[model samples]
Target chain A: MRNIIIPAVLFILVITFVALNLFYITDNASRLDAILVSASDAAKNGDFEEATAEVERFKEEFSAVGKYLFAVIQHNEVDDVIFSSNRLLALCNADTKEQFLSEIEVTRESIKLIRDAEIPYLENIL
Target chain B: MAVAVIRTVILYIIIVFAVRVTGKRQIGQLSPTELVITLMLSELAVLPMEDMQKPLLAGVIPIFVLVIVEFFVSAVVLKSIRLRRILNGRPMPIIENGRINQQNMKKIKLSLDELAEELRILGSYDIETVSEAVMETNGQMSIVLKEDYEPLCKDNMKAKKEERKVPAVVISDGEIQKEGLLKAGIDKEQLKSILQKNGCSSAKEVFYMTSKAKNSYFIVKKEKKQ
Candidate 1:
């Protein structure tokens, strides 16, 4: 009984840890999505100052989770999203509304890629 | 940098767990399939440990999956002799009836020089004296000496044999084993009287005590260390 129970409990603890990691990845990505949307909205209305402030806020939040994200998620995708977000900030500084909106879309796509990569796919199913 | 550290630590812990799942056999003792799995698992774990970019799950998921597959395969092989033979391969008799089995030697891909070297390692320097040499599943060579070359054992000697019993540890470091006393068919009072006769004040004074037979006993006194 002890032998069976010990392994079962360890198995449950391991599953719980993996589930917690998934929950953290999704929650972090969702929170970043919200920030990106707010920044994009400010960018669209030509509110450059407001957009820059939101972008700074986004960078701060991203930095907080950046280390953990790199550890848990695919690095290249996370890197792409981060680079695009940085490019969006640069476009805001240059006051190029057209390029800023384009970079914002790229950043959004990159973020989605990171999230989707973590989701269990057909390749992972096997 | 901290993320890389965390990744390394996690991968180390997980790999340890996976290896533990695969029993405690030494690397050389593992079957061909087990060796392959172990090598692959080590390779899989390295990618995530060194490259923080790779998701921890990227390394962890596959490792756990491999462990599960290996475990399933092992369990299946246990229930089926044919599967076990196919998977782990059977021990091959390289020498039978004082003759080298060339066919089995070729099947095992062992050359004459290697076979002789293995035989020498088993203390059979000359293959001519070996009646049978088998290559065990764990890759160990087991050699059986020819009747003429075999050592004379006790059965070959006409010597008087006496009944012998395993020595029961009655007292260890001041604690008396009641069970050992019971097995020897002696009670606590008898033990105290025996200790009195032996010049030991009590069982506490003795460091080690063993009952060799129904009556024979040995006691080692506890030495004081300054």
Candidate 2:
């Protein structure tokens, strides 16, 4: 039991840090997500200014950060998604799955982000 | 153009987080059950983000739900060893002491051909090269390479009287590596003195540094243009 104390403590501490970091990133992303939803909502309602402001917020937040090869590409990707998404938001009935899929193509775009931001990092780590 | 892009960007963050939290099992190491769950989770996350008509809460809620379920399961697993084994499953020994457990392999529905392929991909050639292979809960095959297959470490790489020591990062970028200083059996003052003699006024001037059994290493940043 005594031999295991420090290892156990350190393990707990390490796990806690990882968990908290995940939580922090999730919380921040979700906050940005709320703004994103509102941006589409505004675009739907013909509120271009509001939609633009929503996107601008994300640009400002991520533009300077995560410049590592992975970060850079993924950040730009989100930039593209939000940019095109604004178009559909402005469409009266264009927010339908067909319109949204055609304009935003969220899944295909997500692969890019995953490939750029997370996959390479994972590959390196492995 | 940007607003729509940012929304997708923001949503990916959550999805990625969920992936990360789901652990490294997503990459090539997944049991059938685990793989299905992973796909289900991804689809669940994507649904809300793509369909604006879907509730705004849809995008974020399932993630929290999964996390809560994980936490609850973890708590139960912690309290009951048997329950832990049941939920998280046990590590089945597929290859025990250089012998394959055919029953275990069949139980997991892994064909011999598939097993051999996976083994070879991970660098194990034969039973001799595989001391053991354990099927992990996440469905990853953990192979402990046999003694001969294991790579030669620095200690073994060197001959007699050429003892090796692990290299340590003494500094990174323009900062004094305080922990590294202590780790290397040196002090800040000594590092600083070395920096000064090297024409660097401060630790900030040093861009990179490393140390080994021999002694120390330092790298100064390029001078700025006047």
Candidate 3:
């Protein structure tokens, strides 16, 4: 009885943990992408002040969940997201409109990749 | 440095617990599936211990998953004979009726030298003396000696012998063992009487003591410090 119960409880816990990780990465990635898109739009409209504030908020948000992300996601993938976000922040601060917009796309793609990898898509599994 | 130390401690505890849960099979006695799990557990634990950047959960989650899977599989395998045979290969006969099964030996990739070495280890210098020898699933050899070559016992000589209980160590290096006292069916008071009878002032004066049956004991006094 104990043998069955222990493994059963652990199986449920592991499944729950994996599900939570998938949901967390997916939700966080979408949130971060939205923030980056907002910043990119602000930069395009010549609103450097709003764009800088939004980029700062994006960094804050990423940092807030960085530890959790690192726990579930691969270190290299998480590191890539961090690197690209920092670059995006620098471009926004320098008021380089075109470069900042392109950097936003790169940052968003990296964040999305992390979430995508968590998903058990056939291509990813293969 | 602190993180590494803490992670090492945690992983040590986890790995020990995992091994304990898996059962008491020695490394050489583990089945193929068990061997794989043991290898995977060590590999998973070492990664986080060496790399502080890798989250401990990265190792822990997979370890738990593997342990759970192994546990569940073993339970299911117990109820299913086919699964058991599939996972842990059936024991093959290497030698039967004093004749070696060369075909089975070849299938298992057991060379003649290896068989000779195994037989030698089993104290069987002559293969013809063995009635049966099985190659177990865990890769150990089990040999049964032929009746003519079997060791002579009291039954063969028609001799009567008294049955005796195995002696349990009651004292070792001046320390009393409670479990040993129980095993020997003696209490502390009886132990004290036995020690007094043996001319020992106390347990500390004794280096080794064993009790067997009622009022039956063996005692060895500690040597004087040089």
Candidate 4:
């Protein structure tokens, strides 16, 4: 009885943990992408101040969620997003509209890749 | 440095726990699935230990997932004979009725030389002596000798032998073992008399003592320091 129970409990725990991770990465990725899009639109409209604020907010949120992400996602994938985020922030601070907009797109894609990797899609599984 | 030390300790504990969960099969006795699990466990544990940037949970989660899967598979296999056969192939009989089953041996890829080697290892120099020889799923050979080749015992000679109780150590390094005395079926007074008979004043004077029965005992006195 104990033999069955321990493994069953652990199996449930692993499943729950994986499901929670999928929810977390998906929710957080969309949130981060929304922020990047807002920042990109602001920079395109010549609103450097709002764009800078949005970029700053993006960095703060990413850093907060990154601690959790590091445990679930591969360190390299999470680090790639972190690196791109920093680059986007640097471009935002410099008020480089053209570069900042493009960097925002790149950062958003990286975040999407992380979330996609977590999803149990046929393409991703293969 | 401290991070490495802490991670090593944590991973070590997790690995030990994982192995314990898999049960007490030795390396040589592990089935194919068990061997794969054991290999994967060590590989998974070493990844985080080598690269600090790799999250510890990355290593831990997979280890646990594998353990849980293996556990469930074992449970399912227990109740399903077909699944058991699929996972662990049926034991192949290499020899039957003092004759080598060449077709079965060939099917399992057991060469004649290998069979001879295994038989030699099992104390049978000649294959003809083995009435039955099976290659178990764990890869060990089980051999049964023919009636004429079987070793002679007391039963074969029709001799009667006395049943003797296992010797229980009642004293070790001058200390009394209460459980051992109970097993030997002797009380403190009987132990004292046994010690007196053996010319020992007390248990402290004896180095080792064992009792096979209530009155039967073996005692060795401690040597005086030079």
Candidate 5:
């Protein structure tokens, strides 16, 4: 039993490390997903300029998500609008600091919708 | 702060137990139902953590209600087929016999482009290659491949595997799984049924009906062939 404990401990340590890494990566991925999703929403609502900038910000923040999320999100028919808006929250930032101090205010509202909509869709992925 | 800590601890326990009751689905996999459940659970799980003023009872009561609701719905589904149909909805046939069901698609508001896109995500490139497609209750699409696209048999569209040999169980250590006996795909129920099709009839006669990942259900009967 004592002999078993060492490898078990090491094994657990390894698993915990991997699990933590996965959690970190997942957090990053979800954030990026939110950003790209918001951008897609903007694009859909005929805010191409906002969408473009959101995507650029997302790409800067989470490269992997920025790279792949657009194609995937576009392919999926978002059944719930709030979920789409939540994804937008992940990507939301001021278009310009001067022109949009109100971006944060808009984002606060979007965050509410995003949480309401996005939280439902997110259960399986996490 | 002490209550906050206590609440967090309690929240974790409740969430974990609820998830366990709900099934391995929280951590394991995502069918449509599981996905929806996960979504609802997560949002709700946050409430207990956030509500500092409300007693833990407030958080716990709703969870109890959810489980009760789940149990009630499940019982209703188990007892009544019509109620099941009304609550869960039937599998919508998105495609049937190699043709898209345009009427069904319109009812679900699914477009042809959307269908193709969903299929592509599932690795089926061409709609013509689909035998059938079903939109399952939890909002996931399942598709049956056309004969040509299926990775089995002498037709040989793909050289993946010819077929698999599944083993029939005669005795599991000493007893038998009766359902395992029939699933060996053998017919003994009626004289009118077809002859010599993958045959088996006894449980005390089988060792175990299992196949390798790519083998047929090979039955090891109690008595050896002469």
Candidate 6:
């Protein structure tokens, strides 16, 4: 009886931790996606200052949750997103609208990949 | 980068503590269940360390869960012999009365040649001379030599010799061990005088010191190069 109960309880705790982490990842992914879209929109409108501000917002969100994402996902995947964000910030600073918009799109795709990776759908799992 | 380094160091300490909680068993002595837990814990701890983007909690929570589960299972197994047997499996007697128990060997899926090889490694080259051999749950063989084949010892030969006490080191690397001194039944004053007689001014001057017998001490002074 104890043998079964011990493992069963541990299994439940494991599931709970994973669920909590999934929700955390989902929340961060949405926030990142929102900021990237806003930054891209600002860049499209030729408002470099507004676009840079949006980039800063994106950076803040990434800094907050990047470490957490690392725990759940691959290092290179997170690093790729970080690298793209840094490039996005630079492009915005240099007033390179075309490059800034492209960087934002790349970063958005990376965030979506990370979010979908955590979804645990059969398609993803298989 | 600094945060990642700090997190790695903290996780390393947590892993050490977790392993300690599992008990002081050698890797080779660990049961199947213990080995699995250790492997999983190692893999889980590396996740946060390898990627700075991962939160420390991601690695920490899973590691703690494993440690807790292992501790609880170990405790439960300790209380119930039946549970221990079920989890680790009971030792099988492979050899009885200098004869190989073929049935028991078949039960554990151990071949006769492998059994002989294990016995040879254990210093029992001649299976005929081994009274019994039990295959422990950890997959090691525990052998009982026949009376006539047993090694000759002082007690067996009834030899008269001085009873030498196991020497305890009171000082090592120029540092005094208070607990070692207490176990050797000596105080600081006696140690000081002994050190002085041995051409040492203080405990710090001595490189090594041991108590072999009552009121007898061996001292080695630290060299200038050291």
Best by DockQ: 1
Q: Residue by residue across B50-120, what tens digits does model 5's lDDT show? A: 65435567667777677676667667677998987877778899999998899999999999999999899
Compared with the true structure, what per-residue lDDT tens digits does model 1 show for residues B27-87?
9799877898899999999987776446778888999999999999999998999999998
Better of 4 and 6 by TM-score: 6
Ranking by DockQ: 1, 6, 3, 4, 2, 5
Going through the candidates in order, their DockQ values are 0.05, 0.02, 0.03, 0.03, 0.01, 0.04
Q: A1-126 in candidate 6: lDDT tens per residue?
A: 578999989967867777787788888899889988888888899999998998898888798798777776778889999889889888988998887787788899999988886776634322
Error of 2 at B221 (Å): 7.8
lDDT of 3 by residue, A1-126 (tens): 578999989867866777777788789889998999899889999998999899889989998888887776567887887888888778877889989888888888888877776676534432
The segments of candidate 6 whose C-alpha lies over 4 angstroms from its true place after superposition are: A1-126, B109-117, B154-166, B199-201, B220-226
Q: What is candidate 2's lDDT per residue for B76-113, written digit by digit as tens?
A: 76799898677668988989888889999888898888
Instruction: Please provide, for model 3 over B63-153, each residue's C-alpha lDDT reduced to its tens digit, 9 standing for 90 to 100.
Output: 9999999999899988999999999999999998899999999999999999999999999998889999999999899999999999999
TM-score of chain A of 4: 0.93
Model 6 lDDT tens row, B1-226? 2333456668889999989888778888899779888899899888877765566788889989998899899889989999999999999999898888899999999998998899899998888999999999988899999999999988889998787778989999889998889989989998888888888999888889999888788888888863
Model 5 lDDT tens row, A19-57: 554454446545755775676567556575787687567
TM-score of 4: 0.56
Chain A fold similarity by TM-score, each prediction = 0.88, 0.53, 0.93, 0.93, 0.45, 0.94
The regions of model 2 sitting more than 4 angstroms off are A1-126, B1-41, B121-123, B129-131, B143-168, B182-189, B195-207, B212-214, B218-226
- What's the TM-score of each model vs. the native? 0.52, 0.47, 0.63, 0.56, 0.42, 0.62
How close to the true structure is residue A47 of candidate 1, measured as C-alpha lDDT? 92
Please identify model 4 stretches exceeding 4 Å from their true place: A1-126, B161-178, B187-210, B217-226
Q: True-contact fraction for model 5? A: 0.00
Task: Please give, as one word, the docking class of candidate 3.
Answer: incorrect
Local accuracy of candidate 4 as per-residue lDDT tens digits, B55-117 = 788899999999999999899989999998999889999899988899998798999999999
What DockQ class does candidate 6 belong to? Answer: incorrect
Candidate 4 C-alpha lDDT tens digits along A1-126: 578999989867866777777888899999999998998989999999999899889989999999998876678888988898888878877888889888888888899888776776634322
| Order of quality (lDDT) | 4, 3, 6, 1, 2, 5
User: How far does residue A107 in candidate 4 sit from its true spot (Å)?
Assistant: 24
